[model samples]
Target: MKGKNKHNKLKPIMKKSMLAALSLGIALPVAGSLPHALAGAIEPTINISRPVLNDDIYWLSHSSEQVDALPIMPSMPIGVDNNTIIIDLSTHFSSDRFTQLGAISENTNVARAYVTNDNKLVVVPYRSGKINIQLQAKNALSPEGEMIRDNIELYISKKGDLNGDDKVDSADAVQLYNYLRNMVTRRGFSYVEKNQADVDRNGEPELADMNALLSGYANQSLGAKDNSYVLTFKQVDDAPYALNGKLNGDLKVGATLTSNIEFFDPDGDTPRSMLYQWYRGSEASGEGKTEIIGATEAVYKITAAEQEKYLFLQVTPQSYSSDRPQGNPVVLRSESTVAVKQEDIVSLSPSNGSTEVKTNAPLVITYNRPVKINMNSFSSIIIRNLTSNQIEANYIFFLGNNFRANDNKVIIDNPGLKYGANYSIEVSNDAIIAADPDDNAYMQGTVVEQNGVQWTFTTQIPQ
Candidate 1:
């Protein structure tokens, strides 16, 4: 059970390499029925054929020519010399199973495998390089569990062999760069294949990986370089605004706004990539905001609908410094207010001179632009019951009592007008009607005067 468990655990880890080896006919044979002489008087020995790289088989962006299997003689007698096998393999996994952290050949320095009791052999490469595959077995003439051993060598290519030409050069760097920039969408390469360009092993191929290749290609040519470096990225926050032109403050509807990051690299001298996202909301703050779709560029145009709304720009910076693999982008949010011409109630409830209104009906007011009101000054605005010669405060709501204010307009609960009463709601210039202070159209002491800002309505019979 222990052996079975270990095999199961290692099988998945070896699936990729195993598939390549199997396709190439290099996998070991099962020990189900060993040489007939094993149980006979003659001792049986195991002999394996040397594996040769075909080099003719090729696949998308890689060569499928790895030694897949080694022919073995299960019934051969002992005393035959075992041959040395050499496999020139690339670091790209035959299958994606090489995606694990320890699967890189440069890390493990060798491949590993074990001979199963059933005469089967399993191999897994820890890292690309000269790896040894050792097998153990015992002849029937010896103890029941006694065994002989042999080893095979596997030479893995260095990382950054992007083109699989067995060399790391400017070509690999160009491929990696184009891929990162999204220029090569159908490169016929799988995820693992592209990962080979992560020469610095920073989890992904970025600017630093390209730099590593360019910096180490000479050493690689000399057969002394591994194209490995400590992947590190410094933490970078949203950069300050460069204020290329004017930013923030008041922007009129239909006007254009442009801005960008100040462009300072935390690595002191390295260049970093930056992106932008624009948001729209009612407040200068980002709460209750929505991203402006397709608003990723630095320049933005204010729409008439955006009047009285706030536009916030968030800048994100990306870095591909090998020393900063764990580094994350920092975001900075800046804002501008869209100034709209002062707006007032473009429309009102209970149309002026309206009669037969329900005693309980609410007064609704709608505006072209959102407005602000100072409920404290409600007293100055009155609804007079002219039929009864009484102030609205005498029978209806008082200051701070029955009015609701929103961005665009206000709603007032029924003043409980007596049935058949004629009432006139008046607003002097002193009435507290104004656009929110945050709005561009906001003014101090006047309500919208479309119809002189006063209206009279008569209540229907009490129901």
Candidate 2:
């Protein structure tokens, strides 16, 4: 009876064991499949928030400015199941994986790109053009992750766009001028804007750049075709030469002469200043030329010393540019030889002989050309009273109080002439001298008379 009871207990225990085995077999398969499903749900993904991934990025850079670092990816979030994120640049990809990074330009002359330590892609553009950049993100969970690629089209522009409107205009030139002269506040330009300000492309935003920008703005206003804001550097300098030169004006003593010389520069350089010099030569062909002292003007006055000599002018074009400051000099000779004119009395204030003379009538004399009064012959000029046989007035006594002499005329104060009395005025030959004396003309106070009279006048008697 005891053996039968034990067998019953053993039977129950065996049934319980079989049930436990069947439950274990079903739970193991479900637990194993759960991990696979979780792995699929937790796959690594790269999220690019900045710059809108897969879109073409347009970047404009000024050639005069330097681009330090431009962030391509400012914010990049990686979603993974506690996996280490790894960022790789397309340039660093292996040969086998290059295709996965997408098409990239091999020419980086215009710009350069690189990946930052924080998985942010950065670009440095040197000039104008299009460039391509590729970025890939991977994790421990997904080693062969997808790439986030985009094309960067960089457009390089010349300097001088101070306002950064992209179009160079008069406003930009004005701004540059104000900035250079410190007429405005110290609102300095950025690296890129500064590059635009360097219109001359000399690596500096100087006065020359401002001038060039202004010129370009003017050309644009005039509807010029080649009115680009950027100035093309002149590689070689060509010296200026005279196309044609000629001298003008009367070639005589006390006359003014001018030069009409046209200059042409092969490089189209405008002269900053023109230098002029007057020379006196013996022959009209410019032989035995001698420079006239203090005759560095566009117009030269013929002097008495230059009479009977050829007058010529020499002009030199000058520029502020250091490349070529001075141009070839041009010499222009006068067409005719210089002549000296003789000094003669042009007119007298009073008639040569007249009655009814007043008591206080001054004497006046006029010359045809400029003449100088001889100080040594001051006493020789006198007004004598013929009726009284006495000298009425001496010119030396009134030399300063009532005597006045000028280029072509002289006046003497009267010293109480006798009313209704005959008077005779006599002037010494040495009293007047021509301003420009020559061997054949105005020889030592040789004054020619006008109307056959030197100077004799009658005034109203006791009006």
Candidate 3:
């Protein structure tokens, strides 16, 4: 059979027998008796041939006598330095003869496989590392099946070693910085080089890497091309740093809650990003707390309802560097703020100790009065699989319709619960809760010790 792609040309498909050879994991001669040779005469012979690349495409082919042989392997290793290699089907057989093409990479994150319009296989590398790629071709001819196959290696460069000088010192750091700043122009680096220069490995070469390099120098620990950036410490919590600011104070009903929870890094490295979340709860112990809607600023106002309520702050500081890879951003979280007097939970969904709850039911908590929430504090509310002791829900903080400030209600979304499973929703002291800003009695409540709340129920069995 023949087929046409964007190139508008006929392509032959490989016989089914060839694809079968691939599944068997070893190349052997196609099923057929060898031609009888004349007495004392040498018999004609053929071997499986390896695929070749032309014009960035890969090509494959095999002789009739070579049907059982495996596809030829690449002559050399391939890597991020030389990732784009091709294998064109038209080279070994007519495009019309092959129907399916398959390719596999040992490490998907490091390399990818692509087929071109003209039926050529293309291998692309994404990072500075080594990966293996394999290719296979199949056709409908002969239900017995036959396949053509090939394999190749790929390699990406070390992170931060843009010049390939085998070192990640001030020279590489300066070069990367200048490149990002467009100070000069030259062309020894390839796609893999920029990836290597991305010291922070955040998919871009940025100033965070420079600052990390500088900090590393100060600590006498700058070095290496490993996937994870090496640092004297992975997070600020281990560093000799301080958290400063107006973390705790009293406020009048009409005044703003003073905010000043700041993280001080002793090495003075700039953070790639910083996050702040304020929480309010009924007790000074921070139980029954919820995130304050849009309270992400370094400071928050003390609304009327928050007048007498206790408040605390939470801050997350992050920094990026060659030592701190993208997926593993260096982060340090501050302890929860001092729990302050807050609002109360007047009603809870599933009625606390209720049983036979629906699997898809939502968890709801209603306050006695209008209340505000601290979004990040939702982490303190854990939904665990009582039988497995596994927490099944991942709380995503969003101030959508799920939360109604006017009604003083907060709804916790559950991803999914198992049928007939016993589950527990435990609210810890860290969850935030606060009264509405319009209330005049906000400051009238005495500071209370709201320990926390926990409820359990069994889900109905699935039909």
Q: How many residue pairs clash in each candidate?
A: 24, 3, 70
Candidate 1 lDDT (Cα, whole model)?
Answer: 0.43
Residues 1-463 of candidate 1: C-alpha lDDT, one tens digit per residue: 0000000010112224323323332222232221111111111211121111111112111112222321221111111123212222212121122111111122233444443333333334333344444332222231232222222233443455555444445455556555555422333433334345556554444445545555455444311233221111011222221112224434765345666444433222234555777788886656898888988877776666677777777665445444432223333344556666454446657776788888777776676666555544434556688899888653122455566667776666666778898887655433334454533332222233543445677888756
Task: Find the candidate with the highest lDDT and give its number.
Answer: 2
Ranking by TM-score: 2, 3, 1
lDDT, residue 401, model 1? 54
Error of 2 at 304 (Å): 0.9
Please give the range of 10 consecutive residues that has the lowest summed lDDT in model 3: 1-10
Most TM-score-accurate candidate? 2
Candidate 2, 143-216: lDDT as tens digits: 33323233333333333456544445555655665555552334544433444556665555555555565554
Candidate 3, residues 191-269: lDDT per residue as tens digits? 3344454565444444455555444433444443122221000011112111333443334332345444333332223
Query: How many clashes show up in model 3?
Result: 70
